[model samples]
Target: MRFVRLAADYPVTVFGLTFEKLLIIGVIAVFLLGPERLPHYAAMLGKFVRSVRDFANGAKDRMREEMGPEFDDVDWQKLDPRQYDPRRIIRDALSDADPFAEPATPVVARAAVNENSAYLQRKRKREALGAGDAAPFDSEAT
Candidate 1:
């Protein structure tokens, strides 16, 4: 089965150019290049693209030759940059994880302090001092 990549998968897209944008670019190019020189530039662009494809194919062939036919058997997907994305990998792995699984212990335990008792004492003192139920005031804003 062919792996069809979804557009949403591309998190680092630039411009996110669509057909409308491409058409707008083409119109702008024609205006800047002018009708007289447009054909010439178009031909040149085609030639440049063709040369790039040829160069890429040549490089792949050279790599295969140097590495032997086993190079072609390499799992290209495993070497993909997305495979190294911690967030995406973790999300996929945990998508089907048991929701009822026991929680793991904290790596670094904090002191067993009774924070609620301390807070209650502070609240009582604030109330005895006629402080409002509102949060503590900050002079920074003023």
Candidate 2:
């Protein structure tokens, strides 16, 4: 089975909460708590946000400490999940080894020989068939 990515126009979400959904939640909270209690709850929310921020900063600091100078040398952008593309990744991996380049080692030479033979076999089969003929199909292989 294959996975499909969402369309570009799809709404951005954070933990399944979109901007509209967050606005709705805020409105509901204001109505439920009323003006008198809203300030108290808002203050608590602010404290919670501050604590979360502090916790994240602390974790980052701890990681920096553990990683030492290497932490600053890291290419953080390359590691971001937002830029991920399975097709691009697979293409890059496949292209990393230049197939046409001279194989310096015995193992790579053998691989190139095998690949060339496979290509030749496929080419011969195609040439054996007429232009109008469909390629041979193996039901058992499927």
lDDT agreement with native, every candidate? 0.76, 0.82
For each candidate in turn, the TM-score is 0.56, 0.57
The runs of at least 3 residues in candidate 2 whose Cα sits more than 4 Å from the true structure, single-residue gaps closed, are 1-12, 96-142
Worst 10 residues of 2 by lDDT: 103-112
> In candidate 1, what are the lDDT values of residues 21-72, reduced to their tens digit?
7788889999998889998999999999999999999999999999998997
Predicted candidate 2 versus true structure: per-residue lDDT over 9-95, tens digit per residue: 568787899999999999999999999999999999999999999999999999999999999999987786766787856765777
What C-alpha lDDT, on a 0 to 100 scale, does residue 18 get in candidate 1? 69
List candidate 1 stretches off by more than 4 Å: 1-8, 11-23, 86-118, 126-142
After TM-score superposition, the amount by which residue 72's alpha carbon in candidate 1 deviates from its true location, in angstroms, is: 1.8
The candidate maximizing TM-score is 2
Clashing pairs in 1: none
